[model samples]
Target chain A: MITPSPALPIAVPLVAAAFLAGLRKFLRRWLADLIATATAAANLWLCTALLRASWHSNIVYWFGNWFPRGRMVVGIGFEVDPVGAGLATLACLLTLLGFIYSWRITDSGRDLFQPLMLIFMAAMCGFAMTADLFNLFVFFELMSTAAFALCGLKTHEPAPLQGAFNFAVTNTVGAFLILTGIALVYAVTGALNMAQIGFLLGSRHDLLVIAAAAFLCSGFLIKAAIAPFHFWLPDAHSVAPTPVCVLFSGLMVELGAFAVLRMTSVMFGQSLLQPHSAFRATLLLLGSLTVVWGGLMCFAEHHLKRVLAFSTISHGGAMLLGVAIGTPAAITGWLTYLFAHAMAKAGLFFTAGILLHRLQSMSEPQLFKRGRPLRFTAVLWLLGGIALAALPPFGLSNGEDLIESATHAHAIHLWVTLMFFFTSAMTGAAVFRVGMRVFFGLGDAGPADRAAKIDEAPDGPEEQHHIPARMFLPAALCIALSAAPAYIPGFGRWFFNAAHRFLAQSLYIARIYAQPVHYVLPPAPHSDLGSTLMHGAIAVVCALLLASWAVFHLALPRGFRGATHLEGPMFPLRKLQSGHPGDYVVWCMVGFVLLGGCLFLLP
Target chain B: MNQIVHIFPYLVAGWVFLCGLYGIATSRHLVHTVISLAVVQTSTYVLLLNIGFRTGGAAPVFADISPGITTVDPIVQALMLTDVVVEATVMALLLAMVVKAYEKAGTLSPDDLRLMRG
Candidate 1:
């Protein structure tokens, strides 16, 4: 049996990225596409090999081959478990799809886009596979910086620039926090390897240890866009190029959640499973709030991309809810949701981009114009929306079913489950509204706007046929692959088993807290004291109060107007958007200091 | 005195970092922002190296045949070296982006740019 090398997937892209950067100056128009496509294809091949090998064997590569040097274990390493390999394959596949999707978009400077994108892919792969905490930090920075640059690719546009600036500021602060935490850990344990750190810190909980954990977890939470830190995400995703936006919303942001899971599993696995666990409760609360908030924001959005962006956040919240459940079934649900969301969201973005290309606008109402062809794009959007809404026969449905089953026994879990269902329904409604506007609204056909919108000139036949087949092929492929997993028995099991291993393997909290502890509580008896008379009198008083309140409020002119007259003060907070760089910097600094202080000072 | 010597490097690193943060806060130009980021990154490198340094340790370079002789922690130094390269790459990319922004906007002053307001 031939086992795959773990380093190739990371090394190939790093080398290719460097090569592309050097050759970018002299490369022709199509050269960038060729290089990016080839590199991504190579990464995909390597990932496939790794996946096949990982099915039967775990691969580990010690850096510099220095692992057996006097039993010191000083060198860093790469540990490619089944889960990491699977995620790496998915990342590479999506990157290749993104490359293909952007093949026709020559407006973005090709020279810069391809290399940065390859670097981003390599960083993601490294982040998934690296065993060292410091290496993880490096890859985290790499992915983030690349993402920031990609967001600002349309640097002339005010929205993308602003979005990129905010993203950079927040993530840089996150990076600093992560680095500080790493420094603290290293100071305490003198180890950089993750497994080594776990072994060293075992059963030795200290103030410094908890402080470091909080700092690290907070940084990851910021990256994951779990609630308040998500303020930067909608703007960033909506303003970035459509394909890049898809990757960012669908895959890049989930890396944060993945980081949290990985770190917690390694560092605080045993501590997380205690009865009435505060950490689990906190996770559940944040996840629930994010779901509701993101759903409401999505419902309020009118722009096409921003709706999807908020929906992505809502889905992320759902995945985190599953993680908080801390069961094998819940982990499987989380992974399945991740897989389905990536495919569905990417396809949705691609379809939206295609519509925008044809209609020359992303506004919901503008899509109804007569000149735009709505049949194909609208159908694709609907399919993607169904998958996103967790309708039956799709991968999301299976995941949602598992999540429901896992959470139905507990009241708090049931409440979170209800929020997930509600938020998904709201997302479905938003998508339906957009679809209705696009397909059935008043048609606007002033003139033949094709010439103005399409970049193809009349004389150049080559340029006229520029909807390039490569662009849509990968999206269709992703959509098909997403649906295929549900039908294939073993494929879902592959991911399910990987997730099971992640939650149940060595260092899991379940191993430590497996024993059931008995708790004694004071018992109370049911009583029916003075029920008949009290019920009759309360019912009569309630009917009277309801009648009086309705007569006063419901029948008045103010009630009919429904607070429409007070629109001026309804959004007074809009004045806070100063658009000044100095103001933004100050706000960022304030947030950083407050968060840092809270992390260190809080008991 | 021993404690002061042990703490001095941290104070220097912190001072540099604070100066960089101040520069970033006050800077109106994109170039200045990039410069401030560089300064901040340099401070991190300083802190990393300082933490790795021992009181009587020699440089990390190999000189003699002895394997266990006093030598500095090479791991942090190597990590810092890689970090420097990454920082340089990020700085270059940021500068390039700033140039592109200037080409489009005709100004480096972020205050005047307001095309993407919600």
Candidate 2:
């Protein structure tokens, strides 16, 4: 499975897509699905190989074996660090799951769907591993194009077109800003390879450099669904077919965070030396805002998919916060959170898909008492919610344990701790609210709502009893995968070391300059009994709060929707999510301006 | 003065980029907004081309160049070419999406598409 070069992961799927496309004219449906699975599996295997090769050092693959000119890296290269390999592998694994989740739906366009997913997978992995800035742009665009089409896949449905249009417009705008930024970076160095550009930059604190960095990150901020640039995410996720949502919510948005971290650490490493304080403060503010805003929105949202989308934003915020901390521990926590959230969120979305397929409605009130009988899915949903809530034994909590330690170490403990607790509680409570209301009919029957009575379950008891294996199986497997990591011996320590090495910019730069890294394996997790207990207590308390809220919901007065009062107080913030493309564009431009000012004027 | 001249195109690119954003924020129709997006995308073309420009440089064509003549940055031009292609493709995709939205919603104004909300 391991190859001599890092490019194998990218090349396999890129080639396989063309191969699949050629065979598409004559191939049957299952055959196309099989090819897609094979291709995804191979890419996954190669990613493991790449991770193995890059454990200690960076592996740079030059195109056509182009030799460097003296100290300059004249040729474009594909650099695979362990973090990159991990992310690349995550994309492959998610694609494989997404493919399997939809295997039973072999309609006429199934061939097209599988190939697009493959290309999307290729572009994502390619972006994760590429060393050249321009090539990164290319891969990003390819990924976005595939995502846009996939969002619009259900074209006959009125909502999807609207969603995809907003997605395309906002993302295209972000893309242009980043392209301009890349051109400016190239302007300064005449170098496309990121390491060479870093060397050329050499600690320059010029205005152009600041602008380029801001612009570069602004685009990714949009992609990451960071607040103010996050308008399109909910719409897109709500309308896109659920399988695609798994990829979009789980991996695609995370790539945006990956991009921001990559550019800062690898390309702008020197520029950050002087402006570190200002940069850190700005990012911390933005990250906190994203978490708070996203959590509050998720708490208020009623639509199931939209609620999940908001949760993704909130988790993205947490991930961004971890990256903004920019410590080895923080990065370690981010990796853990990213891995766990992807698995749990994907599973949650699959369950939502099943809700749509079986009940034909996405409304929470509509599904009340309808899903009551499906105890297995209800348990899966709650378990996933608990994992998402960062329960003590879950991977998310372990990530939180590491991150809260980072905050304490960095002396931002009080603010980050409060925000982290609030955000997680709110998001967890939102999911808890939905699970109880829809699955168990815990809430009051409000005004005898029409949606409450419109259950469209299959007529016969036998048919009603039938659960789609495709949906339930994938959900269970993904949830189990996410949960397994938390208890896996040494997983945390392994992740910690990978992250430490990832944050070691000078080492990465040296490796790119073809220097040996002298890799050292980090010691496995040890007892920090006090901090572990504290974090566990916080998680347990949050879980307790959610549980009590559900119990209290069951005790509430009839015909009352209790939380409508919560939004009344936050009307201004609610209005901020205007759902207009123009408004979203304004937010992005404003965010870009703020980002530039933060870089140029602050500190 | 010479430095300002050298930096002139980037200043223009910034202005054009802001204008495009302004247009998108104010525009009523989706088609017009996408065109404004295209205009913003054009700023990147200018930026890349200007970045690669030399004061007294020849093209990167090898046949007619003398031994030590400075050629403008060919790599950036290559980058710009790729950018144009991507721009074209994205525009096509956006326009297609616009058409679909128009057909389905019977409206091209973004203000009317406020269905999803917090």
Off by over 4 Å in 2: A1-4, A22-25, A106-110, A273-276, A445-465, A519-562, A567-571
Query: What is the C-alpha lDDT profile of model 2 across A419-479, one tens digit per residue?
Result: 6676667777777777877788775422222112222221112223466687788899888
Q: Which ranges in model 1 have alpha carbons more than 4 Å from their true place?
A: A24-32, A68-71, A155-159, A271-276, A368-372, A442-469, A504-603, B1-50, B62-72, B106-111, B114-117
Candidate 1 chain A: 10-residue stretch with minimal lDDT:
A450-459
Task: Give the Å shift of residue A266 in candidate 1.
Answer: 1.6
DockQ top scorer: 2
Using TM-score as the measure, the top candidate is: 2
lDDT of 1 by residue, A268-350 (tens): 66543443455566677678877877776665555677778888888888888887786766777778778888888888888
In terms of lDDT, the best-performing candidate is: 2
Per-residue lDDT of B1-118 in model 1, one digit per residue for the tens? 9899877877887788778778776778978877876777777777777768876888877865377777777887877777778777777876776777777678877666543233
